[model samples]
Target: MDAPPDIHSLLAVLDRDEWFSSCASDLKLALVRDARLLRCLAGEAVYRDGESARHALFCVVEGAVRFSSALHDGSPSLLVYLEPCHWFGDISLIDGSPYIRDAIADVDSQILCIPMQSFTQWLDQNPKHWRDIARLSTNKLRVAYQVIGEPGALHHRLARRLWLMAHGFGSRMQNPSLQLSVSQEHLAQMMGSTRQSINAALARLEGLGLLVQGYRSIELCNLENLVNHANRLGGE
Candidate 1:
């Protein structure tokens, strides 16, 4: 795999991110100044469940992060996989609440961490960004609701998620591939199913020639067909 992009260039792209376009120039500049760039190898914990929500928003510069929550029995359940240009931890940052989920690097990942205090101060000074922030929050809530409302077939959920992921990350790639480096267990947790189910679904997709599964990655063979499957499953 190619080396991750430089943090400064990544930040420049993120600053012009759709979610940040409405933000004031000064506020955006301040955020860029306050952000800390960090890298983590695959499987490293960016933040554990129940950890203090001191780190504000995290913008994925390269690779992916898996956001998950722990069960009462301490088993982790995956919530979602966030990729480049997408962000996480904004809810905790804005509300002054504890992080409700853990964020783990699913691959060698680069991220920009913004401190909550600085984010809040910048927001206070630039009220215009509040509307954009609210829109972003609402969009997240809608996605969460969709995921929760449909907990049935594994293939169905995976299809929808793949579509979303492709739209978020693949739009920028010259030959976009919805390849994922995570395990079946993590995928099952995110889909609210068992590993067996995820395995079965992957087999089915492979049989359809929609995906090519490898030891460490899954290469999307037919992106359009996969998206069509998602649309059908999601009732879109």
Candidate 2:
């Protein structure tokens, strides 16, 4: 296996993307000024539900993190999986409230933790970057709305999610396939469906020749067909 990347090196990678780099620079200047970087092993909880949201927003420099909220009985329902260049804790960071959700490392992860006070101070000092923050916030809201409004069908929801992930992360890969290493249980939680429903949908998609499922990898076999199906579902 390849060696893991350091936090500073991860920051450099985020810096290569114009929008991500600018926001990261502002966040880094505010919080991680001289702070030591931390590492979280796979399956570790970055922040548990109901914990004080004291830390600044966490940027996924490398590896993946899953943001989830507890069900009535305290079982976690995965909301989404975030990878490199994605930031979380925005709601708590903005509202100064305890984190409403729990964040866990899905793999060996490197993240930058900026203090909340420092982030607010930097925002106060530089008003221009706030526009970028606003855009990011708006985009997040749009996604939430789309996901929330989706139909109850598990395959429909999964197809939409795969499309979004492919559009977001596929450019870096040679084939641009959405090969998320997530389990069916996690997918069911994210989609607010049961494991049976998720499995059925995956099977249906495989039958339709739109996806290829291996042990832990799912490849988008036909992007156009997937997009068309997503659009038709959205229109319904």
| Candidate lDDT values, in order | 0.72, 0.70
lDDT of 2 by residue, 1-236 (tens): 12434556565666543345556465545544633445889988888889998775776777888988888987778888877666667778767789877789998987767667767777889877667767556667877787777763567768888776665432222334456667788888887878898899999888888888887568888778986776665532
The list of candidate 1 runs beyond 4 A from truth reads 1-8, 15-17, 21-24, 169-177, 231-236
lDDT of 1 by residue, 20-130 (tens): 655666656666676777788988888887778877777787888888887788877888877776777878877877787778898888887877887787788877777
RMSD of each: 4.5, 4.3
Clashing pairs in 2: none
TM-score of 1: 0.80
How much is the lDDT of residue 9 in candidate 1? 65
lDDT of 2: 0.70
Model 2: lDDT of residue 170: 26
For model 1, give the 10-residue run with minimal summed lDDT.
168-177
Q: For residue 159, what is the lDDT in candidate 1?
A: 72
Whole-model lDDT for model 1 versus the true structure?
0.72
